[model samples]
Target chain A: MRISIPVSVGIFLLLLWEMGCRAWAVPVYILPPPSEVLCTALSQYRILAYHGSVTLFEILAGLALAIAVSIPMASAMFLFPWVERALAPFLVASQAIPVFALAPVLVVWFGYGIESKVIMATVIIFFPLTVNLLEGFKSCDRRHVELFRMMGYSKYGTLKKLFWPWALPYFFAGLKVAVSVATIGAVIGEWVGAQRGLGYLMIQSNARLKTDMVFAAILWLSAIGLVLWWLAGIMSRRYAPWKDRG
Target chain B: MTLVSVEGLKKDFDGLSVLSDFSLSVDRGSFVSLIGPSGCGKSTFFDLLTGAIAPDEGRILWEGRTISDLSKKAAWMAQSDLLLPWMSALDNALLPRLSPKKSDRERAMALFCELGLEGFEDYLPYRLSGGMRQRNALARTIMFDRELILLDEPLSALDSLTRQDLQGLLVSLQRDFGKTIVMITHDVEEALVTSDFVVVLSDQPMSVRSSYELIGTKPRLRDDSYVVGLRREILDMLGGHGP
Candidate 1:
């Protein structure tokens, strides 16, 4: 029933879109209907797949880098108040500067390669992951900490046994947010300057007025984001099954 | 013999005194309960006993020697079970053991059986009932393998019936294992039923208001004339402060 409701809603929306485009006599460049978009996606599968694979690599790599960086950073912040205080401004600044503005600079430095796109994705994914994880660590019950202290547990032992387990749910929540936004970073990086990727394809397709192909690229990006989100959910359930009361 | 003694202990939080000139002693193998007005620093006393916090003034003597860091000497349990939700009952019970071995697991299993949590060893804490979770916490405390156990209202969260059952368990555990226990409780009847001595305290800057030595074997019957009369006296001492 859960799957059916959303599927039905999507189909209804697509049907309405197709009929509206047809009834309005909208030019193909101005508005191609869902049918045209679907046809373009199928007919140009090879090109879409090639470009989509590039974007996928950038998204996944960026997400992996973000996780690697954020976990340690969050841990340091949690373990030492001084580290959190030191990095607090820089962490906020990383988010404050527009990614769109940074993308052009990143492309200039990294030269339109996958590296720049990956870095861009990392920049976007870092904040939520770090903050959520730190919050999770901080959320441990005072009584539990006292119990551990009374048990003669060292700081590292308490972190390993108590804080980490307590924070798993929060970590997963941050991962979900990161995965959903991961594509935006990679795609934006590609938009600024890239030899390949769905975003590059969309730019090329739009310039040539093949709006259907651009829509097709968008569809693939959405699908990739959905897949990443689903994968994170699966991992969350595997690692923190206790959080799943249902 | 006296295993632990506190002399003129004083504690303050930002200039507001909690315990002032507090003093008490627990004999080896005795079950002692601290009953006081709500927020009258009973829990603070347990914290001081465990060396979780240092007393502002005075000294804690363990085995007749002034000492700090009683944490290793005492197994502490708070009102909440403090069981890690992700861990099974057995795993939670084995927490104090840094590197638990096969023998440790066996001992934990034995503790689980004794605590009537035999069938629920593999269950996560969230799966257990409130009483069972407290039993799991108790088992964890026992796993600390310390002679002195300090409990801060460990049974306060349970229903009356469950509380009674655990009261009996605590008494038996103390007797069978020859353990020294100091517990903070608000239940007057519970204090009477389980403790060898009940120390009543006044409101903050809490000091010992009175101490009664119960003269019978525990798990004492709550309805017995002696127990009932002592309960009334303790309640009267607490006055409207009784929880």
Candidate 2:
């Protein structure tokens, strides 16, 4: 019932938009009707799927790399106060610099290939993941750590048994945020130089005034983000089952 | 024979003394309760004894050996009932066992059942009541296989009825298991009823002001006139000026 309400409203809005576009005789270049967009999506389904899959692969690969790299960086910052101190300024600066500004530099360095796109996505995802994970590590119950010390558990033992498990939920929180913005990083990377991906396809169609195809590409991007967010929610549920109840 | 002894222990925090020239000794298989007012350094004393913090000047001897670490020989249960929130009741009890074997799990389960936590083996700590969590903690302390156990106001958080029940449990565990227990509590009646000796300490720059040996067997009746007089004496020692 909850899901169906918004879905029905969305269909109603699309119908209204189609009627307005046809009645006004609006140029397709400016605003393609939802029906025309749907037709274009079906007709160009094969091309759209190819580029969509490329972007999807980049998003997943970039997120995986970010998660891998962030864990160690976050751990170092958590385990040593001095390391956190040293890296704090640089971390803040990295986040402050717009990732979009770095997209062209990444394209130039890694060449107009998937490597640049993945790196760009990784840069966007890394900051939030590290910050969230460090916060989780630092927030473990002090009494629990004291108990671990009383039991003579080693530092690594405490990290594994207590810190990591305690931080899993926070990791998922950062992952959700990263997943939402992941495609933006990939698309921006593609817009800069990539010969493939939905971003590149949208650029090509827009140059030819094929606005219907551009609208179709955008619908595909929205679907990717929605699917990734849903997958992240499922993973969080599986890993942090204890967090759900009172 | 003395099982544990602290000699001239001194401790300070940022140049203000918490414990000064404090000394104590416990007999083998005896239960001792250190009773005092708040800020009397009972926790600091526990930390010193457990090797959690090094004393400014003192010596702690466990079984005639200079104490470096008590983790192998002593198990401690603090007031908060610090059970890991993520672990099940069974796993929390088995924490002290480094590499828990099948028998270790069975042993922990048996103790858990004995403590009235039979069906709660897999329940998380947050799911259990306050009393049940403390029982789980006690099970974990006992599972450590240590002869000496330190309990820091373990029942101070429970309601009166639950507190009395757990007091009874502690008495039985000491009598049946022959464990040398050192517990700290501010409750004069609790100290007098459950301990073989009550060590009363003065507040601030804390030092042992006096110690008394209680009469009678395990779980002395709280209503007995002799125990009643002892309670008043301990309460007065705790700075009770009220008429």
Candidate 3:
């Protein structure tokens, strides 16, 4: 799990891959050499970083927006119950159509601005946080809730005391999974119709048959996801230590 | 006047009756225990008494008034010792303060001292073992001046030694508070030791099998041979043939 060992293993694997492609005498257009990809990424570092920033902004903005909107939405949904009744089926139906398919339509409607990318990210990230957190909120120990009720605690008080802790572990788990999907959603939107961002770069590189550029852009995107994962890990340990995975 | 009065209690689920013609009265500050088998209606009675649900037919009066109109006057502490995992012992103990007061951290901390929970107040429930959580829960329950405390086997989930330890602590706390308590437990000796009155209940279509006043003195719960014999007798009555 440590970075040094994994980096070494990855380097060894990349060396093997680069050697195999050379030995099979495959066209450079098909399977790019790892050495060539690394050089392109270094040469184009500023350009890639600017594009990567666009995708990063979209992912984080949507993630924050989703949490702000959905946590209250989940709490309200749980308390009223009818809200969940009315919305859950439609929410599930949205996920049934893959985001990649949805992305083209979103771009067509919203044009190439960051708005489409952010919308895609919000749609992708909202469900997991809402479902897992709502489940956690509702799954509180009935006894604890009754104890509060017996003490004459109001609805708001009970939510703060009895249900909030129960929901914290669940919220963290949903956030972790949603963070990854957030990247994919942002990329999907950017891929469909965007002038900038890593996804757009990869799309353009693929069209030109510049496999190394595509691969390099992919490597940076994966690195971005890894950072999100690492941050989520730290957050779970610090804030929601009760969760098992932490 | 009785702090809690239950009369002509009856309940049925899907055509199966649990309690029939159940009746009991507890003066304020009295200790009462209900001992029974698994499917017995003692727990159901607690549920009804606490307004967790309404019995199909019954009247429960608290402090000489119907609890239906005074729902907050009774506290039911459950067997699992449910503590909020994210909160510190102090905060969990302070949870009852949500009843109406400001988050009374000082009152909760004072209780920690009184309950021997001083050094452990800031620790989370997960950091403490089962015994410690139960201890914290008892401290929490102490904050309420509710006329009646219904404990649904509040310490049942603990191991034997820990359970015994809690029984002593609980007896002392009950004596000090003088809050009317109706504890439901499968442990007959626990019933004998902790109660001014003991009611034994039978299984499904359940009702009180027998009610007895356990006035025999000096810690009859675990450390007494006579109490153990009575426990066996009660077990036998429940059809438990065991070592």
Candidate 4:
């Protein structure tokens, strides 16, 4: 029923969109019908797949870099209060500056390559992962800490046996959020200056007035986001199964 | 034979005094319960004993030696089980030793079996019942292998039946294992039944109001006339603070 309800609602919405376009005799350039978008997606599968793979690579690489950096960064921030105090403002400022505004600079510095897009995705993904993990570590129960202290657990021992396990759910929470927004950074980086990726394809298709192709590119991007989100969910369940019990 | 002795210990938090000139002595292989009014400094006393926080005045002596770090001498269990949710029951019990070998696992498994959590060793804490979780916590405390065990309202969160069951188990810690125990509890009957000595405390700026020696075998009957008499006397002394 959970699956059917949303699936049926989606089908109804698509039918309404198709009928509305036909009834209004909308210009194809202004808004192509769903059927035309689907046809374009099927006919141009190879090109879309090629560009989708590039965007996928950028998103995955960016996510990997973000995870690799954020875990240690969060640990350091937790272990040493000085690091968090020094970097907190900069972390917030990184998020405050629009990624779109920084896209062009990243392209110039990294030279319109996958490196720029991956870096962009990492910048976007870093804040949430670090903050959530830090919060998770900080959330270790005072009673548990006392227990560990009374058990003669050292600083490193407490972090490994207590804080790391405690913060895992939070890590996955940040990862899920990071995965959903991961495409934004890579795609925007591609849009600013890139010869590949779905973002570039969207810009190219829009310039030619191929609205159907633009919509098709959007569909592929959504698919990639959903897959990443689903993978994050699976990993979260596997590693932090206790979360589900609660 | 004294395992722990506190001399005129005073603790204050931001000018609010909790324990003042509090003194108590616990003998080796004895179960002692501290009962008092709500919001009393019973927990703070346990904290001082465990050396989680320092007393502003006076000192705590473990085996007659003034020690600041009591981690090596005592194991503490709070009201809540405080078990790590991510770990299974066996792993939680094995927390005292971070890196456990085959014998450690076997010892933990033996403790689980003895605690009646035999088949549930692999279960996470959330999956266990309230009583089971506390038992798991007890296993962890026992695994600490310290001479002294300090418990802060350890069975207050369980249901009445579970509370009674655990009361028996607590008595065994002193009888079978021969470990000294200091527990804080609101339940007068629990103290009467399980402890060798029951010390009553006053309200904030806690000091020993009185102490009673329960001169009888443990797991004492609730309806015994001597037990009944002592229970009423303690309750009356509490002056409406009784649980």
Candidate 5:
């Protein structure tokens, strides 16, 4: 509800900019006002839209890849005592190496394509994804656990009823963080080398000092992140609704 | 008729012994209350009888069978009796009975009505008060064909009047259902008023100090002369001199 005021203010600012640019007779290429920006977006909508699609695919693919890997990895960490004990040190150390630092190297090996971008996104998002879920895995109430043992519920049943729910909140929280990281990861990969993308457009627009195009690219990044976060929130609210129900 | 027998039961925690050679036997359908000071092994004995914990040494025989869960004869209600926080009182009570969905709900509702917790069928455990929660726990434990219900100070946290009310209700229900109960309590009067046999326990390294059989009939009497005398004797035995 509070967003209405900020949105109105934002609309007003855009109007002021368009009027200022129109009154000053500024060149469209230098600093396109709101009108020029919107017209350029409409004319080049298909091209920009294609790049937006590519960026979104990279983010989704990275998310899917991280999810597929992290779930099994976290489950192993949960199920097998020794593996978690042994791997904990390595997992902690892996986060020390930043994904931005590795993006260039990934591009060097995989060339100018989606493979590198997806890998970068996975690297950026994987740690939180695994750690959040793992933290959830370990936080089960001992009382409930003892009750399960007393009832003669096997390990699998305990996992299904207790451990899974315990971890679900953390999993969704991780997913929210991962959404933002994913967008950043996609942009980072594009910044290094890309034929087409919002990130590449940002780079090109900034070189020509076209702040409007750069802002538009940034707007796309934020919109994607917001949509993904909103989706995560919806899923959590629908499924892991224990908190609200309480 | 010996319903449950605990012989030479010894439980050691680290180097300290909590219960040493503790032995007791309850007649069939007898309501025995273990009366003791806090830290006495009354709870441990109840735990052993109910198969909540295995005794370090010796054996417990329940109804001619070695104390085991195979026949599902016993249920334990602890001092901090836990209910599934996610479930309603009705559902909580229905836990042990475990039937098909439709039948289970009907039975749970019936049990809730019987226990006087009829209106709070869908409310979670957190929503219920302490007395109401215990009522639910009691219903849950006895919902199955539970022969022995181990009550570990179930009403210890309630107000004095509330305790008295619940105790009277327990006695009436026990008479109606004929459940063999082994309850642990520090209150001497509580034991004398509700139980058929009361086992007095010594303070630490606890063993039976004395035992008394209430010389009263069911539909019990709190103010009966025998109940009053036994209650006084038990309280005096615990070192708090009776008026």
Candidate 6:
């Protein structure tokens, strides 16, 4: 009942949109109706599949690299205050320059290849992942930390048992944001210079005024982002069930 | 039979003295309590004893050697029930064991039964009531098999009935298992009821102002006039009416 209500509302909205476009004699070029977009998706399935898969690969690869990099970096910052102080400013400064501006530079440095796209996504995802997880580590309950200290648990043990469990929800929160923006990161990289992927296809379709094809590409990108966010929710619930109730 | 001893201990936090020139000794298998007014550095005294913090100028000896030289032989249960929120009561009870064996689980389960938390083993810390959580905390403290247990107002948050119940459990844990127990409380009567000796302290820069030896049988029955008289005497001491 909970899931069906929102989904029904979404279908109702799509229907209204489709009818509104047709009733007003709106040009498909200006705004593709739902039916035209669906037809484009079906007819250009082969082309869409190839580009969608490339975008998906870049986003996932970039997100995985971000997770891999952020875990150790956050841990280093948490475990060593001096290291956090020295590096945190640089990390903050890195985010000050917009990622869109960095995308072209990344393409130039990495030769407009998949490497640049992946790196761009990684850079975009890394900031939130590191910041949220590090904040979680810092916010560990003092009593719990003292309990570990009294038990003679090593610092590493405390991190694994106490810190990790407490910080996991925050990690997922960061992950959700990172995953949603991952598509944006990959798309920006592809837009700078790329022969394949949804972003490149959108640019190509837009130039030709193939509005339906552009909308189809957007649908695919949003689908991937939605799937990633849903996956994060599932993972968070699985690992931290106690938090689910609260 | 002296299990742990603190001599000439002094401590300061940011140049504000807490405990100064404090000395104490705990006999093996005895239940001792420190009862004083609030902000008397009673908790700080336990922190020093547990090696959670170091004294500026004193030594704590566990079994005739410096406490630092000894491995963790004492468990400290604080005023707040420090059960990990993510863990079930059973897991929280067995946490101090680090790598819990099968027997550890059985022991934890047994403790749950003993602590009146039998059916709530799988309940998360948040699911348990405050009294149950504190019982679980107590179970965790005892599960590690430590010789000395440092309890900093472990029952302060409990209702009168539950506090009395846990006080009984503490007495049995001391008498039956011969665990050396040191507790701190603001309630003078609670100290008399639960401990063999009560170490009273003055308010900041705490030192042992006086001591009261509860001379009676186990459980320190209130029906005994001696207990009543001593309680009055301790209250007088706390109220600043003692010599």
For model 5 the TM-score comes to: 0.75
TM-scores of all candidate predictions against the true structure: 0.96, 0.88, 0.91, 0.96, 0.75, 0.87
Query: Clashes per prediction?
Result: 0, 0, 0, 0, 0, 0
Q: Which stretches of candidate 4 lie over 4 Å from their true place?
A: none
- Give the per-residue Cα lDDT of candidate 4 at B45: 81
Inter-residue clash pairs, candidate 5: none
User: Scored by Cα lDDT, where does model 5 land?
Assistant: 0.77
lDDT, candidate 3, A206-227, per-residue tens: 9999888888898889888889
State the lDDT at A61 in candidate 5: 95
Candidate 3 local lDDT, B156-218, one digit each (tens): 899989887778777776677767787888777777777778777777666667777766653
Off by over 4 Å in 2: A1-28, A31-47, A80-89, A209-216, B240-243
How much of the real interface does each model capture, measured as fnat? Answer: 0.79, 0.32, 0.82, 0.82, 0.04, 0.61
Models ranked on DockQ? 4, 1, 3, 6, 2, 5
- lDDT of each residue in A1-246, candidate 2, tens digit only: 989999999999999999999999999999999999999998999999999999999999999999998999999999998999999899889889887899999999999999999998998898889998999999888767877887778888889888988888888889989999999999999999989999999999999999999999999998999999989889988887666753
Better candidate by DockQ, 1 or 3: 1
Among incorrect, acceptable, medium and high, the docking class of model 2 is acceptable
lDDT agreement of model 2 with the native = 0.89
Model 2 error, position A183 (Å): 1.8
Q: lDDT of model 3 at residue A119?
A: 90
| Each prediction's DockQ against the real complex | 0.72, 0.41, 0.62, 0.76, 0.19, 0.50
Q: B129-200, model 5: which lDDT tens digit per residue?
A: 878888887777666556676777888888887788789867865787787888887777787788888888
Candidate 3's docking class is medium
Q: Is candidate 3 or candidate 6 better by lDDT?
A: 6
lDDT of all predictions: 0.91, 0.89, 0.80, 0.92, 0.77, 0.87
lDDT digits (tens) for residues A1-246 of candidate 5? 688998999899989989999999887667778876776666777766888889999999999999988888898888898989998888888778776788899889988888888888888788889989988988876655655555555687778666887788889999999997788888889889887778888898889887777766776777888999999989888767664655
lDDT of 1 by residue, B120-169 (tens): 99998898999999999999999999999888889999999999999998
Ranking by lDDT: 4, 1, 2, 6, 3, 5
When 1 and 6 are scored with DockQ, the better candidate is: 1
